[model samples]
Target: MFGLQACAKAPTAAADAAKPAAAAQDDGGYPLVTDVRLQNAGNDDGWLMYRRDYGSSGYAPFDTVNAGNVAQLKQAWDYTSEFDMGHEAPPVVNGDYMFITTPKNHLLAFQASTGKLLWKYEHDLSNAGLKTVCCDVVNRGVALYQDKVYMATLDNHVVALDAKTGKVAWNEKIHEQDVGYAMTLAPLVVKGKVIVGVSGGEYGARGYVTALDAATGKEAWKQHTIPMPDEPGGDTWPKGAAETGGGAAWLTGSYDAETDTLFWGVGNPGPWLATLRPGDNLYTDSVIAMDPATGKIKWHYQYTPNDTWDYDGTNETVFTDIDYKGAKHKAIVSASRNGWFYAIDRTDGKLIYAEKFATATSVTGPDANGKMQTDPALRPTVDKEVFTCPSFLGGKNWWPISVSPQTGLAYVPTLHSCMTIKGAEVSYKAGLPFLGESFLVKRDPAFPNQWGSVQAIDVNTGKQAWTFPSELPWNSGMLSTAGGLLFSGSADGYLYAFDAKTGKVLWKSPQMTSGVLGVPSTWKVGGKQYVGVWAGWGGASPIWGGEMAQDPKVKGIPLGGHLYVFSL
Candidate 1:
């Protein structure tokens, strides 16, 4: 029933007829989001992009919903999209309008102050092979630039829509859906270009990042994550395996205005087994910095070279200025999937610090160069089974972390699971799963009942300030506010408010339908502060790590498709 209508135009007349006169108050005029607006996005007015701003701090400066008054918050409004797949997109707010995307690539615009539907645009992917998608049919969100909204579809198409009217302006096919390429990340609008990345590392597709003209949808530049034989990191990969190397830039990247650099994390190499593709696998499990204008790699740092445990480096590279080694440094930090937290100098890609944040059994620690001190015995072979910590679900997945400059701490949502892996013989096939390993994911033996945690790490010292444990793995991302509160949702259907200084749960409310898989966002409208998040329980964990999903802690969570908002 969801896909029955190919392109259902929003009934504008009916929506206008239902609007209440009292809800039509003009706080300000809707203006085009320019470079200036993006740089100042953290100001108390609106949440402009996926992680609030180009820095990906995920922190809001609004204090209306501070620690003292957050307990008095109540649901202001609720809206259900009724499509019922994973609702992972964070709502983007600009002036009085808010935009959000649902599963299957349905973009909806609504009045920010009042829950009035402005317009809706649903992309039709019925003819595309839905089964080819490695994960569930999920979308992260949309980007707003000059009067247009940009969203990447599940079928590997980047479409630009007129922001005011929900009309398609241009649609460009970035990758072939038949060959296991899809785009689920929200496009990042940098200067005049819309940047996006492809998905499907599990199916052996070569990954790439492309930039397109924001106005005409014409490709401006493209950068392949996997390099050829003569490329810089080519020697790290086997002779010809670089052709299908799996360094997927599947998540949205962050930008540094001062350096004119774009930071993106790459995913794991092909075939979950390590022996099949020998060597460090080049840049697969690495973070790459590039020049946005030329799409040329500036520098790269590999986190888990020749990663065999399926540890993807596609986590957010949060940019912040920290006091490291008793001196102030411009740093980019990440709570990596390999169960370690790393801090690097963004200007030169030099390692500042690296430490384990979760139960990592495969890695002992970081060496002088910050590369993991890997245990050779932990590598699984075709003839032997090996148990490794921080399972394929990762110590942390694509869910975002919030960094509060006010508190000088990074709030990380983490998974505390492990896996037993055994290699199997397999051959490469395009459009088919190239993973040559069998794995059973489970919670760590020491803490079999606990599966998730929210860790507050002091970015400067690379030390965890405090940790808040969860019974189930966190499906939601994080939001930090000037009120000294950290907001995050969970697989148990509750959106929690925590004290930023201490790991104390101040308040929480049940979402009532399903787990919260989306990130939380904050914005101010009509002088009132509001917090919002999408309630839906679907993502890679449920699809790839089926055993972990069926664990007693998370088994009762149901599917959902509703947007929950609260205010004082």
Candidate 2:
């Protein structure tokens, strides 16, 4: 845990002076959000990545439309992704152009103001990729650096495309799909290097993040999440299983340029069942800060050690400066899938404090070291169903969380459900990967109303500031603005606006879509600011096929595949 004296310092670097930063050419325009600091993964211009910024705050401080007349917001334009598994691409906006991808891997370049199609690139990934993907087929989005766009396909290839023309500049293979590896996360570009991580935590693949020369597509660095035998953190896992230990950094990570540290949140261990691999899984289910220059780990803080609940720590790591206990502190905050909101000292990767943000009945509290209080009773077992709060699905899934330095509040989209998990364990064999079976059980009486909640917490106090209730899961990422409003979407097809100070529902509109799982982004084009979000459903909710499928209320609403933009 981060002690009282462990205050973080901003990584060294002057603010981008209207030029793209890093290894790419300085575009002489607004800097790119190469790291994880902005919502839409960059600045407020157009969302370049999943978080809109490297901090993964999901918050945009721009406010052309404010509380005074947010109800007047009207549809600016709409773009249909044309493939309907799940529209998760966050649009990357530069000047008047916006580029986005669909769940089926269709990349489209559009006029940001009118949604006029510039060009589209559809990738025909091999059918072999279908088998490698554990869940539904989907792409998170793409990254923009220099004059090119970078994206990883489900077929396990990283392709660089010219930004002005949707043409492939260069394509390279980071991993092959044959060994049960699929690349779905967005590629991150920093300095002159493009960094990407492999997915398939559920498929028992050796996870690693590879850095490539952005210009030549040459290998720069590769940091394996799972350690080799005799290497550091190697003794934690069973002999040869380290390769399949599953500490995938599948989601987008944040970067502190001043410290030269890249912060990545790792996923859960493989095979789900804890009895297979023993010892505290070092890098898995933890946040590791690495040097972007050499990919060397600087510091790490584990959220769940030897996790059995399938609680991956692969959510967004939001970086911000907060006034804590009358002292200014550089902090990294994350709303973890493990049902806890953690604030840590980013500079040294120290756990500052953690608070339960949702119904987490598995553990009582953190131990003296600030690690999660592991409950032996909640550990998975064969044929014996143990009810666990926050389920494997978690108190919070991958929907992005937002932090407003203006309001001093962190907004989180949360779930309040639980599941009964029975772990049927088996031995791990090469090529066979891992064998474990688990199913969901819903027993709580308050399961329906408790399904979703949007909470605003005071970062300084580590307490709830306000909350907005939801009839469905809070499955969408949040966006906050200087206009004193918070914007978030729902699986129920409603896009909502709430007061930043009070959790008052100021306005609501039916984006007319189900299961909106992507991060919403906003930007100004033609001097008129507009808010945008991809409204198509699909993600982990289908895998369980439990409450969301059987719930008598929401079963009728079909999935969606469209993009919605709004303006006043």
Candidate 3:
């Protein structure tokens, strides 16, 4: 009931993102993805959900095709979706079945080893949906439960489908699409509940996360990212400002079964002009740890208080134990969009160590109490334009970071750019963009001319170990393996396999049809390990990236929706 409170327009949404199944080959049996099985999925040879496990590490345990044989990798199979827009999903596989989602909520199932299309679910979106999504129409991936495949659509829908037939099972509306609310992150299925987060903060929509009953599609629990008047942290926002204060929980969160905690990242505050709402803005740019069953918030940590540069803290939280100050502590690490990397004590929400991984000038540093201290002179105002680092697209964004148990390092796809931002006067209208600011992405002369790179951070010390720079913004998600190999794609259309310990590129795939915006995943079928990634040139960097998008090297990248699988 704590949804949009702005008095402007009516809003509503649908339940499902599927329909009549488009048959391909014979549909296979459903892959049983139980809560227990998913609990140990990080050690499994399959990918059951987004980022493969509750850790949300974007890593797999397969080692058959690794650094030793990566150079011999050859195309094993390939498939293309009918629709093309930012193809952000990882090639998710369970048993011998592979599931992938394309833009506009299309989910396709295939015979894992042979690339034979099994069944396709083409979701039809209303024309009104075009006005909802703030970024490209992208679906990260699908969730595989016992007998169902789950997807959260861009039209603010939570849908369940028959895993074997791609037939619609149940569909439930999360919010009114017209209210500027949409769901792009893949549904996280935990203990019979389908959890999803809302986006569209730019449109002034209040953000929240909902958990639908996996069997019936009924909402079990819901929690708004922005605190209410009587709720905890409500004092952070003044008067009625909390109603439209955007703390969009835009990314799928990491789960810790050991403590029964769900660590979700809250995005930026709305109306970009921070002075308009005042206070630390509560949970806006922070991570909230909650109970998975009842949606009760336990502890929260803020990354950038009163964020005005659009530096959303909605990055995947990777769980790992880090050694700091001569002691080993369990932590959750996030490479925040505000240009800082943080490792917080997962148990108590205390800062263990905070480090700068990119060129940043917006903040002075973290204070004794761990609050991020900003450069007051750099605050963007209507009369004063200020230049900042790590542009709004982030030092790193929702592309996801993978932590490797083998390397004891987190592999991050880093974007290096800055912005010149200025505040503007704006008012909220139902389903309309609410950002009260103007900005342009640009290069920072203080850093190298490179726009992106893949940096490996030493978890123990919270220091960057090595960097693999790119000519273009590295938008692809990173995937690490037990074989001591790290895999990631390029905006130039090649997939490279690097030695996880060193930053040496051991193997690079031939150029594909377009730049890569998809995350890479690996799984085993019939005892053979295979690597897969989607080739498509579309994402926020090219859309919101102003002058940077017009760079000579970035101008000609083609659009596509091809899923390519490789094997040694």
Candidate 4:
């Protein structure tokens, strides 16, 4: 049996936003992205942030080119990252300049209209940094604010660089690089705060989210995921392991400007076993709403308590307003790694409803709060191996799901995979991927021939609308336009558009040399609308490339590193 731990004190807020004095930096507050971050303010440009906005809907309201002329979209230009790995960064376009980050942490500013390299910034990441990265070695993307671009390095340092000159400005060490912690998600800027989360929950590091003074590089606040004795969540952890309890806050978060709340998704608990440290871990594998001004958690809902299958709830918690039972309510939706689609009241973190979108047997019914009811038998034992429906990689990984408010549904690229899990005694050693033992298993048994799929789900009804199977698993992030069409890339190097109502493939073209893995973006440039995506194959699939390599369909497809922009 797992030992229930004591909780820690609720993490404290560091900065006082009520101070009327001017910031120490030259500017009173952080500058806004005049040409980029707010580009969609009717100027007709490109996507600025991961998930398009703080909402993480991956939906752009622009619909200049709809289903009729989408077929005419041809390649506008292609820019190569040259470093390869996985080109997962989405390009942010301002006027004519497009900013992108490579997997190796090289920041580049390119000509959006013509594929011309303007400037590239490369950080001297320590060799030690390379060794501690637990997953794919790459940076997800960058955040553009004021006239500077902010990026968190694999070495756990958040560095601010001149957006135009590509020159380093102020740099601060956010976390120790030797602790197996890193940053891969794009930094989110809310009001004047630059918010970022740590990665390495799988590697046994404490998970937390930090807010920094965007202009002065001053520490604003820090919120720990797990709790220690005397803390609000201290009672949720084992007696003494709360400090080391893993609850990594990865991926970007959602912002509710009306309520001044920031909603971020938290990753799995440490050690990969419930028996190691028991009790419902406070914030692990949960969606938490925090006060951006003070970093105090307003409310939280744990998606998977004492998670043993590694089903992280750290995907985008997309903000959307829906009519429930005839009344309109603000809501946030997430397709968690636990293989369930959930809708919650964004205002107070109350469970509205949840349904399994995949073949999940770990949970039977909904808890009183509407969360999936977990089967106690699914929890791993010291000497027993348990096979779960969706493996540690999750039914849905980091791929951003596209939500069409027009159709009131979300289109997701779901993975039909499972991991054969077995827990072992593990010890946390700084600077190494923490875990005692590993497992080897097949992903999908029923449809071994199919690994990936694009499924349309009705957010209002909690039912799958349509399913479009992919030859390979883990396609790419999705982008939906007002054109009544959904755009996404596949591991087969094909960029496709499917009818939003019905899962029908309307058009597809070979845009990348290898399988595509990054999210897709659409924008209007030169009076013509264009769709864009980074083409590179890297992620957990490639990390377990040996298992994926056996699939004949994705067998010969090489990895690619380039950005393809299409316009009609």
Give the TM-scores of the predictions, in the order they appear: 0.94, 0.91, 0.94, 0.91
What is the C-alpha lDDT profile of model 4 across 76-111, one tens digit per residue? Answer: 777655765777777776545567888867888765
> lDDT for model 4, on a 0 to 1 scale?
0.75
Per-candidate RMSD vs. true structure?
4.7, 8.0, 8.3, 9.6
lDDT of candidate 2 over 145-261, digit per residue (tens): 767788888887888887766889988987766576777787777777888888877778778888899888989998988888788888888887787887878888887777778
Stretches off by above 4 angstroms in model 1 are 1-29
Model 3 lDDT tens row, 1-568:
0111112112132111111122122234444677777787876666878898898888787888877888899887777666657889998887767788999888998766667777888877955546868789898989878778999988778889887779899989878776878888988888899889999778887778889999999999999999987999999999988888988988898889889999899999988898798889888999999999999999999999999988887899999887787898889998989878899999999988788998878866789988788888989987888988878898898899999988899998999899999989999887889988999999867656788999999988879999998878899999999888999999888899999999899998888877889999998865788899998888787789987899988877878777888887
Position 22, candidate 4: lDDT: 21
Between prediction 1 and prediction 4, the one with superior TM-score is 1
Candidate 1 global TM-score = 0.94
lDDT of 2: 0.75
Which clashing pairs does model 3 show? 12-176, 14-173, 15-171, 15-172, 15-173, 16-171
**Local lDDT at 175 for model 3:** 83
Query: Per-residue lDDT tens digits of candidate 1, residues 54-155?
Result: 989999988989999889987776687777677899988876678999998889998766667889999989888866676788999999887788999988
For every model shown, the clashing-pair count is 0, 26, 6, 21
The lDDT for every candidate, in the order shown, is: 0.84, 0.75, 0.84, 0.75
